[model samples]
Target: MGPSRHDQLTIGELSARSGLATSALRYYEELGLIHSERTAGGQRRFARQALRRVAFVRAAQRVGLSLEEAGAALAGLPVDRSPTATEWSRVARTWQSRIDEQIADLERLRDHLTGCIGCGCLSLGTCALYNPHDIQGTDGPGARKLLPRHSRTA
Candidate 1:
């Protein structure tokens, strides 16, 4: 049988099982995203439940959340008890809007990519973006105005 809640894992064990480096795990604790019990020798001991916390942190990161944002989500869970499925569901749902917005942004970028953004033309050389000496090109290379309308600036 696997280790029970009574059998806490050392930092290294938690790192190995969670696929996070030992330093990352320590940083998580420092950020208050995860917590560990202290041994008499001042070493860290993580409850088995910590694995689930690490998973949540990683998943949050995959969804583009900052460490602080992940910590806020994890904070909703009770520190004294393990997170339940229902609790996880509720917390994860909060990310849906953020994910959808990101998807929409990606779609817009993909659809407009490789097309003349500023000038209406069928060729690249005539486009200011393609001509380095053009006024718009003075800003520098890259999709400068390709950002969202509100986000774009001269």
Candidate 2:
């Protein structure tokens, strides 16, 4: 055997090596985040490179990136081959702005909470902090009324 032919791994082996559950691997495949081939018995077989890809996806999630964003970031990788350091760096750079924005939002929320804890505004229903209309549209996801996730129906 030439070089022991380590090109592919069964789904179970991939799961063990990547430290991910087989269901999560399947979910990732379903979400277009990973790829696999089927054997004659219809079992999934993944490329060995998928180990690194799975690790990257988990790391991205740990950093609070949604699966959609992670998928987009990972899409830049070439499926035909494993990613190089340069490729990984390029993908990581794409997240810089998102990370910065999250940090800024967290800081703003922290300051708001700290500033409001001792303020008399908490006693007044008309205060921005206590009024839904006043505070709801002032920050990130809810900056605009009727955000997609917050849509109201008649």
Candidate 3:
């Protein structure tokens, strides 16, 4: 007989429902982003709440959060049940600054794309004009001007 709605899901079942590969699910489990129990035969079994957790992780990724960050957010949620609306809202509020930083970074990229690639590669003559003898390189590695303002070194 098929498992009931309240039954735990096998890895394949979770993968199919979540639209993630089993390998990815394994990775998430390894990272503590989601969790599963072991069957007597050592197969993984995930609570149905794992679906909501997986969705939460995907939503976090859509906002440009790293897996570590998503895991941290998930840590705020209840492990035994789906989060209440208030609980979800509280967790989501913590992401605002990160999302704002991403928005600002994208805006900076969009504003600069026409002028400088900002990799400090100095390949373009225009880079010479903006970067001036690769001065941005001293500001620390990576596309300095493309980085969010607070992330840039003085």
Candidate 4:
């Protein structure tokens, strides 16, 4: 038999349970981060599994993954069923380095917050010594010195 009504949640129910706005749920469906079906009345109904998927997406966001990245990770899971612990671990492992990089970037920003950002703003009196007449502007736009080292071109 097809899934019973109990096995599926109306958009309103899902929104209430997931703590996400119905509009956000629709957006997530559009982004392919979650899926839903239509009832005879054309209202969206989501499988209970969508709750888990929504939670996973929220967790990914907390770790700084973009929606695109979270969608990609979700795509790796089995579409026929929820992912096993091992499957979840496998996908999560790929984000470890990315999370680490974000941590490093935060630490770097914290350490440098009191100093010149080298954006050629020259707002700080100390910029005269570090940037020296906005010389860092010669490199490129943006905060040249404050940007991650890997992002600096010259």
Candidate 5:
């Protein structure tokens, strides 16, 4: 028999198993989100555990985290060590509120579309949804009202 399944996986094998294109996997590597080693032939080889890391990254992306965020989460892993379960759990907990906030934003946007945009009333300019109490929800229309007063950068 050849190597065990837990042994090194070729780049194509990692891509196939992770359901990410080779290019995307390469991009992930470039972003420091994943790691690999080169074979004697200069071919890329990934550890089997990379499958789980890619899945975690995909899940984070689905919940609206940028690759930078995911990479940051993985950054603390020791250079010679794979991420421990505890470390992953910490990362997940850290992003839980962010995921919740994204869901809330989506829900709010959906409600707005269903009620505001879908409203067929003729007087669109004088709608009650805008500038309630003259507080100036937004200077113009749309979710400009939802803009935060603080900075969004890390």
Candidate 6:
């Protein structure tokens, strides 16, 4: 028989199985989120663990993590093997902080909007809360500053 299907998957298989497009998978690889060993003919070969990694990456993106942040998180996992429980937990903790910050920001925005959205001051530059450029939350890098926890690099 030929090689076991799960022993090493081709890039196409990884993309299909992981529900990510070939271009996205390539982008992930370029960002150092995933790895592959090249065949003698220069084709890529990926272990089955890549399946889990891809799944995690897709989920992270859905949660608004930029490719750079997701790549950094995934890079913490062992490249030669599947991720350990501790590694997974560490990533989870980081995500939790991002989610928490997003929640708090949303609550503040909601409260402020409810209190002042229709006060006929949308066009008033002098209004404390209506200036388009004056965002109402933290104004620096990281979760406290943005709506979604995306890295600036991506």
Q: Write the per-residue lDDT of candidate 1 for residues 71-129, one digit (tens) a residue.
A: 88888987667778998789878889789988986775555544555545522334433
In candidate 2, what are the lDDT values of residues 112-154, reduced to their tens digit?
6666676644422333433334553344333343233533342
Candidate with maximal TM-score: 4
Q: List the residue pairs that clash in candidate 1.
A: none
TM-score of 3: 0.74
Q: lDDT of all predictions, in order shown?
A: 0.74, 0.73, 0.78, 0.78, 0.72, 0.72
Candidate 1 lDDT score at position 18: 93
Error of 5 at 99 (Å): 1.8
lDDT by residue (1-154, candidate 6, tens digit) is 9557569989999988988898888887887777888888999888888888888888887767987888878778777677778888988888998888879877877776676666744323333344324545334443233332332321
Residue-level lDDT of model 3, residues 109-152, one tens digit each, is 56665555546444322343334435434554444454443432
Q: Write the per-residue lDDT of candidate 5 for residues 1-154, one digit (tens) a residue.
A: 9556469888899999999999999999999878888877899888877887898789888868899987776676544456678876777787898888988877865665566576644232333443232333345645446444552333
> Would you estimate the TM-scores of all the predictions?
0.68, 0.70, 0.74, 0.75, 0.66, 0.71
Off by over 4 Å in 3: 1-6, 117-135, 138-154
Q: Tens digit of lDDT per residue, candidate 4, span 1-154?
A: 9999999999999999999999999999999988999988999989999999999899999889999999988888886687889997897787787899989877765655545554644432234333343533444443355444344223
Clash counts for all predictions: 0, 0, 0, 0, 0, 0
Higher-ranked by TM-score: 3 or 6: 3
Q: Give candidate 1 misplaced runs (Cα > 4 Å).
A: 1-6, 116-154
Which stretches of model 6 miss by more than 4 angstroms?
A: 1-6, 124-154
Model 2 CA deviation exceeding 4 Å by range: 1-6, 119-154
